[model samples]
Target: MRKILNTAHIYMIIGVVSGLYSRELTKAEDFTGDTQLDVVHTHVLALGMLFFLIVLVLEKQFTLTSSALFGWFFWIYNIGLAVTVGMMTLHGTLTVLGHSSGEAIAMVAGLGHILLTAGLILLFVTLGKRLQPAPAPGSDAAPDPDPAAPLPAPAP
Candidate 1:
């Protein structure tokens, strides 16, 4: 859980930095048309920062790390995101400098998207495996609370 929280925090910082980078880079280049950098900011914020925050909450509820596939999901998803973001930055920089990005960039970006897709598939598999029925009450397994249950009365 701590690790998940830490990952979320790191992504938030990276997302903010990416947004600032997009703004400053576009301003520096004076290129007003659509650029991949613009999308990079939102992608990092939504897919990296916000996604990890959701995962952190899921970790608290489901102990995601206990799943064998969780480690793979973590590493693969991060690598995919990094590759995608890096290529977007590169392609955008070239565009800002009035250079055309070639087929190679598109191919590599496609690979990054493929990895992201595979990672998401792995995450879903892990989550499915973790969705076992709750352990019986008082059997030493962690309690799975009913969200609709009434809150306990405060101690006197």
Candidate 2:
């Protein structure tokens, strides 16, 4: 949960910095038309910062990191975001300078999007599994739903 919170914090910083950078870059280049830089700010904020903040809350409520998928989701999602945003920054900078890029750049960005999708699917699956009710004691019908989860503390 701490890691999740820290991730959100880092992303928030990055997002805000990117937005400021975009504004400064555009002003410096005197480019008025829309570019990917404008969108990258929102993408990093919503998908990276906001998303992780939500995840941090979910982790607090559900102990999401207990699941293996959580780790995978973290790494894959970060990698995807880095790729997508990196490409956006690169492509947007080039556009500001009146340069065009080949199709390969766009294709790589598409691949990053695909990874994002996969990471989202993994998160949903992890949450679904975590939300399943633990089987009743001494009932063999379903066995234990999540063996790795610690037993709840006894009530006072």
Candidate 3:
């Protein structure tokens, strides 16, 4: 879970940096200049920061890392996000510098999206399995944080 939280913080920082970069990109003309970097911040924030936050919440609800696929899901999702963001940054920078990156960039970006989708599916499947009937309110079952749960458990 610590890894998840740390990753989320990193994502937030990157998102903020991206936003600053985008703003600076347009500052040359009083915010009138268009920038390909316009969506970088949102993408990083939503996919990186927000996504992990939701996972953290889910982690509290379920023992995600106890499942075998959790590791796969985590690594795959990060790789996909990194690939997608890297492609975006590369393409955007090239465009801003007046260079045509050609069709490869689009193809690579599409591949990244495909990986991202696969990772999300893995995550949802893992989450869905844990969504079984909840304990009745005020039952003997301890409400989450499951005092007994291991500290190293990862997020959903």
TM-score of each: 0.84, 0.84, 0.79
Name the runs in model 1 displaced over 4 angstroms. 133-156
Clashing pairs in 3: none
Give per-residue CA lDDT, model 1, range 35-132, as digits (tens).
Answer: 89888878888888899999888887778889999999999998898889889988988998899999999888888998899889989998888887
Q: What TM-score does model 1 achieve against the real structure?
A: 0.84
Q: Between candidates 1 and 2, which one is better according to lDDT?
A: 2
Compose the digit string of candidate 2's lDDT tens values, residues 1-156. 889888888888999999999999999999999899999989999999999999987887788999999989898888889899999988998898899977989999998998898899989988987886767889878654465688899999
Which 10-residue span in candidate 2 carries the lowest summed lDDT?
A: 139-148
Model 3 stretches with alpha carbons more than 4 Å out: 28-33, 133-156
Q: What would you estimate as the lDDT of candidate 3? A: 0.84
Single out the weakest 10-residue window by summed lDDT for candidate 3.
Answer: 27-36
Error of 2 at 49 (Å): 0.6
- Residue 93 of model 3, lDDT score: 70
The lDDT of each candidate is 0.87, 0.89, 0.84
lDDT of 1: 0.87
Model 2 lDDT, full chain set: 0.89
